[model samples]
Target: MTDPADRGAFIWYELITDDVAAARTFYRNVVGWEIAAEGQPLPTGGTYRMIARSDGGNAGGVLDMSAEMTAAGARPGWIGYVHHSDVDAAVKAVIDAGGAVHMPPMDMPGVGRMAMVADPQGATFYVMAPTPPEGDPDARSDVFDYAKAQHMRWNELWTTDPDAAVSLYRDLFGWTQEGAMPMGPMGDYKFIQHGGDGIGAIAKAQPGGEGSRWQYFAGVDDIDRACRAVTDSGGTLLGEPQQIPGGEYSAYAHDPSGATIGLVGPRKET
Candidate 1:
């Protein structure tokens, strides 16, 4: 709804899941979020489950990864939304910047412009500049209230070479590398501010552990409760949750299928 061009995370996120209802329940119970039906079907079929506050405002959506999409090898995860003034130009920029377009620009009968793309390192995400809603964007402060137990607070990309990734995005979307974000052994982090303000991040990938991948941060009010819940829910604690300098705490974990995700919560802000 706001200017995607003025940029800073204009669009937040969307979850891609095989079982929409399961995700709905997990989020509702763990994160304290509520979902309302978009009351519309996607081109492939199934409804768009909208996350919102009790008063109703658009936080994001739960994208049902259907059998067809899964059979085609579509993995379930969150697709990051990037702001774009023109979908075609964005797609072209992706190709020109060494990234691949996983899905070309297309129109949603009701939704605005959208496209799917993968970075040179093979991480997948989406870009969408929403169309004007029939009414207006929700004026609620707690847009993410419905899924209070959200496992992802922020999404960060760990790269082997920050310079290469930075160069690619700087060329692709005109994003600027602000400064270094320190994360213990994770090494110096590069914070990317797109369209002058939209914030995303990139870091040197952890050696000998995992390859280049995008990680999402799940928010929790109580870190201990959240960690315990993860194990109880058939999820694996990838590492112990630790308190970051700012009072915020986080750790790595995997869902039932072993998709890596992060658990994050409010911490001291400098």
Candidate 2:
């Protein structure tokens, strides 16, 4: 019975790759997007290549990783789904803050109530709540809807210790403190909000940083033409395109099977 406009993030992203036709020709010649293979079914099995959204919707799904799932190492990233109303109390507030319950709140019979966390710096993600989908999922009735891809607003956290991951997500999602920015060479970023709802930001990890991860901002209208279409589709830009603090305009890249992704744009009217 969940169809209040399909709630939020009907399906934001999945992308766990091995090849799938060169990751759908490298995100369709870099983010102008277009790869709707239509038949989704690969958590580790067979078909999966529905990353459509050049106004086609269904904005995510691309798997091709089974060498026994990357020899059980499972890295080829991309995982972000947060529209939780209560995926078992957000997996018990990510195991009461120490965060580690990698999958313990299942129930996808219809399509909702998921759970898979990590956060004490292992940094995985997934905590949704969108069910009741069987026959109106899409096709110009356009019911799956995420507004048109790139709808996660923001969600960043590159940490080694941004004040203990911003006090462990501000006491597990009560969130606050929306200030602080000096990402000059990645020194101080800390900008978390929730009740005020800018939806994300938190930084520090850089001295060999490759630990914490959960970065997705996506919006896009045109930030230097999507950072030159993520460097003409090869993708790998990490920095050198900034202007943060709300007027927006981000860059940070990856996706040619690297999978980090961030490309905001718009929102500069102050």
Candidate 3:
């Protein structure tokens, strides 16, 4: 059985891309992550590269999408993995709530059971019942820590139907819709809370945007330098870094593989 305390936590993050080598170089230079030189061989096929922070903690991973996966409509993007007590049960709940399954529940030798599912608005993410390694029975994942640099600091969802999307996530993961900030005509940016902390927000999708999707922000030491690195490393920033409530700056960019990513940090004078 899965622990109740572990439910609804963002335990893992992954970047699925076609050009693994280029992505390795791009993210290494931009986010300062230490990606594994060689990926760990998967039982089914191909490899999965583990990302680590400067402190030697696991941050996330890079998945080299198989031809079959791409042919089935998979695209390059960052997806968050939410921990659930039961992978199978979670998939069912999603289906019952108007969500669609992208991949049925499956187990990997060491990774634990997981499945891919999309929300009613077509935003995709993973639900997993992770398998802790031997001797670490109570291991907790810190991949989504907001206070740690190089870790995922925010999980924003821009959806076509904000009200329905918020309700679906609240039912599935026990997340709460706390307070919100008005965004003029775009609509309110509603904050999401889980485990007693503000994890991210759900906002109405703007016209001409990517429709509906989740965009995670990785914390860095310097926002200006990080934005510069994005362009220098073959990625393009969506816009200038904008200051947020906490006085830090956040910027979004498209990696070389056309995968969207966000960065958050302080602005240092050049």
C-alpha root-mean-square deviation, each candidate:
4.2, 17.4, 1.4
The full ranking of all candidates by lDDT, starting with the best, is 3, 2, 1
List model 2 lDDT by residue over 1-270, tens digit each.
343332333245677877667567666654556666554675546566666666656566766776776777786777877555577876786777777886688776666678878877777878677664567554222312222234445677787778877776665556776778786977878777655545567887777767778776566666676666676767777886677654656777887677777776653343
Candidate 2 regions with alpha-carbon error over 4 angstroms = 1-26, 31-34, 40-79, 82-106, 109-125, 128-165, 168-187, 191-226, 230-240, 243-270
After best superposition, candidate 1 residue 87: deviation in angstroms? 1.5
Q: Tally clashing residue pairs in candidate 1.
A: 23
lDDT string, candidate 1, 13-57, tens digits: 676777665566555544555656443577785556777534444
- Give me the displacement of residue 122 in model 2, in angstroms: 23
What TM-score, over all chains together, does every model reach?
0.81, 0.29, 0.96
Q: Which sections of candidate 1 miss by over 4 Å?
A: 2-4, 8-10, 36-40, 137-152, 181-186, 194-200, 207-210, 257-259, 266-270
lDDT of each: 0.65, 0.65, 0.90
Q: Rank the candidates by TM-score, best first.
A: 3, 1, 2
- In terms of lDDT, the poorest run of 10 residues in model 1 is 138-147
Which ranges in model 3 have alpha carbons more than 4 Å from their true place? none
User: How far in Å is the alpha carbon of 227 misplaced in model 2?
Assistant: 2.8
